[model samples]
Target: MNNNSSIDQSYTHLEIKIPLDPSANERLRSAVLSRLHELYGDPLPDAISDRVNAELDIFYNYFYSSLFLTYQKLVNCINGSGLPYYLFSSNGASLICYALGMTLVNPLPAHYRCASCRHTEFSNSADSSDCGLILPEKHCPLCGALMVSDGNDLPIEFFLGLRYDKTPYLALAVPHAMSDDAVSLLERSFSVTRKDPRDYKFPMEEGFIFAYLDIVPTDSDPESEMLWRSSSSAPSASSASLAPYEMTNARVFEYLSRPESFACYLPYRDDVQMIKSLLAADAVSVNNISDLSKICGLINSVNWFGFILPSLKSGAVDYRSTITCREDIFRTLVAHGLDSETSYRVMEMTRKGRAASILADNALRQQLLSHDISEDYLTSLVNIRYLPTRAHALELAMTVYRNASENVQG
Candidate 1:
């Protein structure tokens, strides 16, 4: 059976209606066809058309679960015990926008500024149609810089197709530094991965950052019928602040210890050795993950994990299921490699857990006490360990001090 068979089964009962207008469907089909031809050849084959249609159907089918997994990864990277939030964008640099979007998390807005005139605009409009904000026709409002649609033009269409149900969230993915012109920002945003690799320059903000708030509907009707309602319909005073994540990409390092602790990477937990091998292999095509199992089976005498599962052999892992599982597995696996961290504090904390549990004998405590981490430090660390991220640690420490002070005063 597929690795995510258990997860898929639970959500199978919840059916969501996807309202597809014929005009919108046709436009999507045309765009897909054009895109396919651009990538392959002028003459598109019937097989290619069939495959594209199959992919689209799968994309629309598992929207909710995909969104959930995306949100979960962002939350884990940003809120883990040893990690910090800024690390997501600051270290992931501009790449966080793509990673977050690829994982189905809300993407931060990417902006481009005019070089000569310093005219700046959103890369994607909030309207969610094209998913990019372009300069007005050939004119930079600030410097009359002639607009040029170059390679750096944001990958808007790639993001638009991947969006979940429209939710109002603010993503500010500005790099800390940029050339006085828009071209540099574009270059920095979309350069070859090996050339720039996701490095965050000390004085730059050339990437996506996230801040999310609830877009609660005022009307009590079901979510499907609640269209055309303005976000401004609610009173501004009552709006809740969306929490912030520190912007950095170094957060990927925190995940390295995850494999040691959890026995498998959280992003690709099942059949992990194969997942890692696939990730390491550049020749492996992400377009079809089942082929990996097939190849594995062939090499292993044609009796791999799939052969062991009767359900999967009976068509349980259909195209829709594979897409859902593959997107999720790949998203998580990449995320494991993308987040950054200052140190492996969560692992240390887990050691502390084991010490406090059945191993709480005085001999064990004394053994742990021999380390640089003192008993008092360990106590404070344990208390503050529950705090969300490194950024919030200071506030939590202060709160602990204040609470102790108030008790003494009372």
Candidate 2:
């Protein structure tokens, strides 16, 4: 109805329409703003508020009318079960989604937040890396309390795109035991009339549910539901205790560094063996959660492992400073004085396997060089056929962490 070209015109022509509550947007806004204030203190930072409001506006104006009811239904079903789960991919990296309890990942830039004084300070300068975990130890200036360092430095654009027009999709991973029940609930809720019973179809696998709602036609007004996918896997006993939006756990990272722990998440035997070999040979070390996250990204990518493994094994490049995920490229460019937009463009291109073309552009090349971007870095980007997001990696790492912790306790 807004006449935005970015919205799929086909959606407008559909005969079905789900009646949305008039107060839904207002209620959502209130909840999100309350969560923001709770996380960042009263009178939220102008920058944070502006960014959140802008995203909210996009959702309200373009997406909420179509997806809100379905999302609400999905959330209700998932939360009703009391089972631990995580939203995967860029959707998981949204601050609004995190605040809405729709995701576990927090998309704020690397920062330190004090629990006592509610003081928050971003640490993403040229000198400091984008990873807060590696930042120098510091105490809150106001209360002298040690501040908690967290955040994955993911931009909202990663999920919503530059124009905020991308059709948002949700991919969730829930416990295997309740997957069938969740799917049945969704089917009943959406009045699902059709389904594709396929297993391990590319991204879909056993315990995966992909459903689209086609409401029964009626005499008055027809209704339809938004399409979404859910994946279920066997979770470790310890995973059930994970608190929502909890990111920092030193014990988890310690467990993740062990070679055998890689088996927890890596599905293939060979991939797990490769990672174990790397760890055994000291080819790569998992010093923190971020490091384990990089390993996740590398293993899932098309060419990154084969491309970078040699250098790592030969001690030519330290695994700690190497690029594994798209965030690494974005952080590197920003650290070299490139604006965030430009940095994101480069990162996006690289993820889409266009890094070679990026280096071929003379103007962009000279600009990058002027900012002291190394040719080696650009070359490294060329090898990135596909890159996983830090959000997904962290989610997987956290899952492994929870499982390992439970095993240790037992």
Candidate 3:
């Protein structure tokens, strides 16, 4: 028994050294600064540097090193596999991740960036409210090349918290064909075990729990393919041949507004049917990315769809006015003169189904009412059992955008 115990201890204590590169921080800093210079031109703005530095500091200080190492390993394995994948959550909505090439979504405000001269411009008055794809075309002032419109106006707070307090979980969607292989590769690389086949847990120090990767196995083909092929009213064959990046935002929204086309974006068959019903009645409109995102959030939530559908049908509330996502609560309150911390608190409470508790405080309730927040809006918050984040909604919207673009370009 003593010999068996000795053997068990030896096995458990096997030295596994994944050395942390001493220069990693400096390298990351240099790479980020270089990319910013490339994107916004040399003599980088002070605001950009300060923001990036702060984010890096948070990462270096707050985030566990194993998380970064695991992410790098997974990315390297995925790239080697040659299967297409996309970051499917707030991680995708990060500027730092984009700069690091860990994600493709650029989280900058809606703007045009000139590839030739690196000239950038934000022409829209309501920059955060608009999608860059829908913006009017413009040529670079410094160069004749047409400027590229990108960015979802996603704040870094969506990825990190308001105080850079949130610990991130990496989520990625890989083609179903290679998901098993992806999981296996990740497990082998980490030398760690997964209780659930889809979630890979990384070894962390004591008290540093919740470090895991969520691998979502998804169909590789564009969701809109079947709809395009089946619909007689679909765009012309020539128009359908446009590349993903070539398709304009207006065209994408037009396609997404169709019940059949929009239904294709939904994951579950029941959700597809429910959304079809809503779209068929014209109770919902997909005018822009934000609208589409809200719809995504509505369907995924527990009571959000039921709560807003009647109002939408009766024309009492439009999609824009309703609190479809947690971000709406924050944005609305902040816009109506609430302080950032208070707005965030309200958002947090509302999302966690604690709005009743929030209202129970007379001072807080009075403060909300004093800001011209309607009783109806507060009531809607109380009904919310579950709410999606704006980051999540935007990620879904971007997925649909990319899939629509690919479907058309095919």
Top TM-score hit = 3
Where does candidate 1 have its weakest 10-residue lDDT segment? Answer: 84-93
Q: What is the lDDT of residue 158 in candidate 3?
A: 66
The per-residue C-alpha lDDT of model 3 at residue 59 equals: 72
lDDT of 3 by residue, 63-170 (tens): 434445455566656655544444445664566676765555566667777878887786565844445656767888888899887766667776777887765665
lDDT of 2 by residue, 264-326 (tens): 544334456667767877887666566766776666565766798888889998776777667
Candidate 3 has a TM-score of 0.78
Model 1: per-residue lDDT, tens digit, 173-269?
1111211222232223322121221222222222322223111111112221111111111223111111111111122222221223211211112
Clashes per model (N, Cα, C within 3 A): 39, 0, 2
Clashing pairs in 2: none
Candidate 3 accuracy as lDDT: 0.63
Candidates' lDDT values, in order?
A: 0.26, 0.60, 0.63
The better-scoring model by TM-score among 1 and 2 is 2
- Please state the error at residue 295 of candidate 2 in Å: 2.3
Candidate ranking (TM-score, best to worst): 3, 2, 1
